[model samples]
Target chain A: MHELAVTREIVDVAAEKAEGARVRRVVIEIGRLTPVAPDCVRFYFEICAAGTAVEGAELEIREIAGNARCRACEASLELAGPVEGCGCGSFDLEILAGRELRLMELEVY
Target chain B: MCDHCGCSTEGHEHVHEHTHEHPHEHETSRTVRIEQDILARNNRQAEWNRGWLASRRLVALNLVGSPGSGKTTVLERTLKELDGQMNAAVIEGDQATDRDAARIRATGRPVVQIATGTGCHLDARMVKGALEKLDPQPDGLVFVENVGNLVCPALFDLGEQAKVLIASVTEGEDKPAKYPHMFAAVQVVLLNKIDLLPHVSFEMDAFLGFLRQVNPRVRVIAVSGATGAGMLEWYECIRASIH
Candidate 1:
């Protein structure tokens, strides 16, 4: 899964920042529409963090909801799922959020 | 050896013996708001690959679709029809076997096969390797037939000039809605297997409506590789892109 690849990058970036410090927890922000499965990320984070500074560390994920602005109706709406068109039947909408996958913070000692 | 403030002499002695203590406190928490995109790295690689291809003046198209979407058949007919007019090379991707590559090779064009071996999609790095191996580049079309998958392959960018999503009528009219990301990211939507339309209940209006809803900018071309219907326009699009 692509989540595994993303997890590897997270682990690499966290380890680089840790700089020999023992990591206690890692917090990540994931958007709902990012195409990455949260369960898959959690499963792979364990595998990727093995033998690294973030080993056995807590993996925290905060899911962000998808938000969009309708161009036709000029209404801001939170997407329920992956539906693209607006309530006004307009596909010309701009995505605001919920496509984010970022490593937010790290707790270390 | 006893001190007035020491509770335990052994522990106090160890504490006093450690002289490398720093006065400043270390931060226990560090915040890094790395709002980096997950696909950013892959996109970078894809851009690099694109630059390399562009430097060589090669036109590459990433053909994406589900299994049995007539991708290979379309390519076969394309090569046969455009013989001597366009010099084409193929980079065939599959989970296993060189069957697609073999078929393309039979068309008398240089073909390279990248077998993923259980990987559901082809990443930019894989294509980069294929391009490196197939050097001394030709000046015409380079078709990268991605692994037969609708979902996973849609996420990966293979450094092609255009991403072409192929969906046959036999699959159903709702494919564009079901796999909107694939359709949304593609430049051209090839509706293949129109020859079987008479045998199947494929609604053209509903399909076009769904496709437009997902991506209004995507150009649609319907063709039946088996019967050679509506292939001229497809060939013209390819030729125009190459030129």
Candidate 2:
């Protein structure tokens, strides 16, 4: 639902970066913990980027894997879905990385 | 549509009509290295709002939670208790209707309502626009009642000093565990509706247990807006934040 707003921001950023030039490709990074869906982003990108410099541009979404460590057992593992509790029967955990939401690079014409 | 040099085509592709002309090398095909956050605009706006509020010494608290987390109830109770002693204002963000704003106005406090027709969360731009129309006391509290959504609201920065989240006992004890982002983002959580503790099966220790796991620094206060339980402590928390 909020993907549209975030996509608008992405398109707007790409447009600003183009500075009136045409966009060819856009590279975006999303971590596993981030709730943004790559599919939804691509869908909204079509609408928000229409008739703009980013229109029809290739949207390359990079999904980063989430890494976390269980606080109870000190076990390191990949974080599961929102509802998935740790294997150690403890909700306590430390997120090491993979929460990035960034627009890394843009190819423009 | 190309923005610069005014050379746009239906598609990004330019078809050579008859002869193969040297591929025009305009600053067009260059890959710009921009390591920027996708939410740069919003983050920048949030920074602007932060500076604006700081200039006036205004303390803003962005209240966010599930739709029935007793956010408004908490605010209503707080305003009722702290009315005369503190001069506070509200910016209500409801999907539609000014009912929440009207409810806050009944307390005789200045309030502004921002109805996001389809938007799920309150962004920094909306708060900046609201600030332009109302005149809250300098160094006063600005409570931005974000649209009742734990997920989307957590992603937005409304330039508030803190995010006050409330979850009723009626909801699942694992509410924070389910919505880890919101729990981790907020500075405090008001475990509201404790008055019905007997009627509900919500485990206090379990709820606090999950909360501690997600946000060790976030303070958790038990309250019941309906019965005015823990209102004084909540007020004290607000006072400490402002001063």
Candidate 3:
């Protein structure tokens, strides 16, 4: 799964930031439309974090809802997944949010 | 020594020592604000690759598709037709085996095979490694046939100018809706195995409709790698991109 590769990256980033300190928690923000499964990330994070500074660290994930604005109609639409078109029958929709996958913060001892 | 407990004599303070290991009970913890993109490393490598390609004036296309979508077949045919006309090389990515690389070598072209082992898709770093080994010339076409996966490959950027999707008629018309990310990411769609249209239960109109619903700007070309049908259009499309 792509989540496995992504989790390795998460562990790497966290471990580097920890910098010899034992990590207590890792907070990540994933958008609803990012196509990354949170459960899979959690599963892989444990495996990827083993023996690293992030080992046994709590993984906290926050999902952000998809928000888009129609370029043609200028209407804001909240989406759960990829949509065919905006409600205003326009294919020109600019995504405002909900494609984010970021490591927000980390708690370390 | 006696202080609170007062168990010792005057001028002495009594202290209690812990026998159990309480590692973090008194440890001070702090939160570090990172606020960094998770794919930042991969994106940085991709940007590096983009610069490398732009500097050499090379156009690389990332061909993504399912396991049996005939990507290698289409690629073999494309390389043969472009022989002596346009210089080209290939970067074949698979979970294992150099079989595809052998096939490309048979076409008398420079090819590099990247066996990802347990990796599901090819990342930009892997492509960078392949680029160094392949060393395709300027004004040439480099086709990167990604691991035959519609899902994971769509999420990775290999610094290609455009992503081309190879989907056959047998994969069902609802492919676009089923895998929207892949459908939305590609610039061109090569609907291969058009010769099998009569035998398969694929609806061309419905497929096109579903494809349009997901990606309104994507160009779809129906071609059969087996019969060499509609290959001219595909070649023209490639020529348009390079020129």
**Which parts of model 2 have CA positions greater than 4 angstroms off?**
A67-96, B1-28
- TM-score, per-candidate, Cα-based: 0.85, 0.86, 0.91
Q: Give candidate 1 regions above 4 Å deviation.
A: A17-20, B1-29, B136-138
Off by over 4 Å in 3: B1-25
At residue A98, what lDDT does model 1 achieve? 83
TM-score (chain A only) for the predictions, listed in order: 0.94, 0.89, 0.95
- State the lDDT of candidate 3 residue by residue for B1-243, as single tens digits: 666765666766446798997676668999999999999999899989989988988899999999999999999999999899999999999999999999999999999999999999999999999999999888888999999998998888899999999999999999998998899889999999999988989999999888877687899999999999999999999999998
Give per-residue CA lDDT, model 2, range B26-138, as digits (tens): 56378888888898888899999998888988999999999988999899888888878877889999999999999999988899999999999999999999987777778
Give the best candidate by DockQ.
3
Provide the lDDT at B64 for model 3.
97
Clashes in model 1: which pairs? Answer: none
| Per-model CA lDDT versus the true structure | 0.85, 0.86, 0.92
State the lDDT at B26 in candidate 1: 60
> Reference contacts recovered by each candidate, as fractions?
0.42, 0.70, 0.75
Kindly list the per-residue Cα lDDT of model 1 for residues B1-243, writing each as its tens digit.
346565556434333566687778766666544555556677899999998888888999999999999999998999888988977888899999999988988989888899998788889999999888777356887899999888777777778999988899999999988977678778998999999998999899999998888787789999988888999999989978987
Q: Is candidate 2 or candidate 3 better by lDDT?
A: 3
Ranking by TM-score: 3, 2, 1
